[model samples]
Target: MNRNRRRGKKLSRALVTAAMLGDAGTARRLLRRGASPELPDAHGTTPLYAASVQGAADVVALLLAAGARPDTESGHGDEGTPLCAAACWGHAGTVRLLLAHGADPVLREDHGTGRAPLDWAERGPHPETALLLAAAVSSRPAAAP
Candidate 1:
């Protein structure tokens, strides 16, 4: 099936697939046709989340530029944030990109346990990635009252 011919929810799914595969072109086309960057898969992972997890820096950038909220959480509880997903997989570039787009490192909203992005990054074996996350988190300004 031609990806361009897909419609409605199908286009949304295709967008997710494209984001997962890091196919920036197809994802761009789908987004142009109204496929939401915030659309979630059955697992509740948004296209941006998928792109972050797969280390698709370009796709992540495209999604972010398309208005995908950097703080949007997935369905896995406290581990579902786009930042957490990227950090878990040790995608340093993706993590940096998300941070640049305003992803909160301390956001532990809904990702399973209450783990923040830095927590997830620490769980991985990538010390450099963990260091980056730590720096980003520590460098964050305190929330205003």
Candidate 2:
């Protein structure tokens, strides 16, 4: 493996580990130490995306605050965005955090899944999440709204 590839893998592992362990402080420390927030794992899963799917709100917040791009899509799984992953997993707080951080709710996966964040929200077991997504979709500007 080349040096850059090795470095990326190390960073990816660190971020994923921090996220999975729910250690927001450690994750932030890594970021401050120059770890790349956009680093992806072997499966192309970004730390932010993983944190969102796992419902780690503090991790998500720390990643975002440290400049993790909310709109970043995982290179695996049909280019799934953090918002979509969060919504699909019923992580209401993560979804809200992503949206508030400007995650595009209408983004579609590259796999032609037709699975927008709103779609995931609709399928959620949580009523509050469903309602929030429904209202958000309904309130979208229609080019002239």
Candidate 3:
């Protein structure tokens, strides 16, 4: 990788690890050091996405509030989106936070799976997650549908 790209990867890796570990301070520091919250690692997972999958609500909020795209799609597997990951993992708080930040639970799916956050939530381990996402989807104006 080029010098700038290499540095960017390091930052991205640090941010993702911090988010996964729920180290908000480290995450903030990395972000301030010019880390791109949306930058994915070799595993194709961004900080916000990793935070969501790990159920690190604080880290998810931090990344989202810092302007991370709430709908960042993972580059892996039926891939889905951040909201999808959170929902599938039963991170109700992360799902709600992302929705509050304008994430679309209905975002397009990868691999033509045509799955949305609601779809993932339906299969989630927590029933409350499905309820939370259902309410969020219902809250959006019908015009947006």
Candidate 4:
């Protein structure tokens, strides 16, 4: 690979690490330095997805503001969309942030074998988060018959 592509990948890895650690400051620094918020790590986990899994609302908001797609899926099998990760971990606020940023509540992960965000929340036994996702799901317009 070319030097610039390699550098971009390196920066993306650093951003993902910062996001997982919930270090919003370092994430912000990396973003300012031109790290692509949408770029995925080797595991297909984007920085936003990492922050969502960590329930780092501040970092999530930053990444969203920096143009990270709220619905970006992560990992190969177990991890699905960012919303799925947040909901699975019972990260209510993170889930809410993702919803507000247009993350589809009904998206499934793991090649369609994984559960939707609401299903993840319910399975997580996070009653409040489940309720939140349920409401979001209910509020969406139904498909045309």
Q: Whose lDDT is greatest here? A: 4
- The local lDDT score (0 to 100) that residue 51 gets in candidate 3 is 90
Model 1: residues >4 Å from true position, as ranges? 1-6, 76-79, 109-113, 143-145
Worst window of 10 by summed lDDT in candidate 3: 105-114
| TM-score of candidate 1 versus the correct structure, residues matched by position | 0.86
**Model 4: how far is 67 from its true place, Å?**
0.7
Question: What tens digits encode model 4's per-residue C-alpha lDDT throughout 61-83?
Answer: 99999999998778767577889
lDDT of 4 at 111: 65
Query: Alpha carbon lDDT of residue 132, candidate 3?
Result: 85
lDDT of 3 by residue, 8-74 (tens): 9999999989988989899989988999988888888789888988889889888887888887787
Q: Assess candidate 4 and give its TM-score to the true structure.
A: 0.96
Q: Give the TM-score of each candidate.
A: 0.86, 0.86, 0.88, 0.96
Error of 1 at 98 (Å): 0.2
2 versus 4: better lDDT goes to: 4
Residue 22's lDDT in candidate 2: 77
Q: Once model 4 is optimally superposed onto the true structure by TM-score, how far is the C-alpha of residue 135 displaced, in angstroms?
A: 0.2
lDDT per model, in order? 0.84, 0.81, 0.84, 0.92
Give the backbone clash total of model 3.
0
Per-prediction CA RMSD (Å): 3.9, 2.4, 2.2, 1.1
Error of 2 at 30 (Å): 1.1
Question: What is candidate 2's lDDT per residue for 1-145, written digit by digit as tens?
Answer: 6987787688778888888777888888888777788888787878998798889999999899878899888866655888888888788898889888888778776655668887787777666777767776777778654
Ranking by TM-score: 4, 3, 1, 2
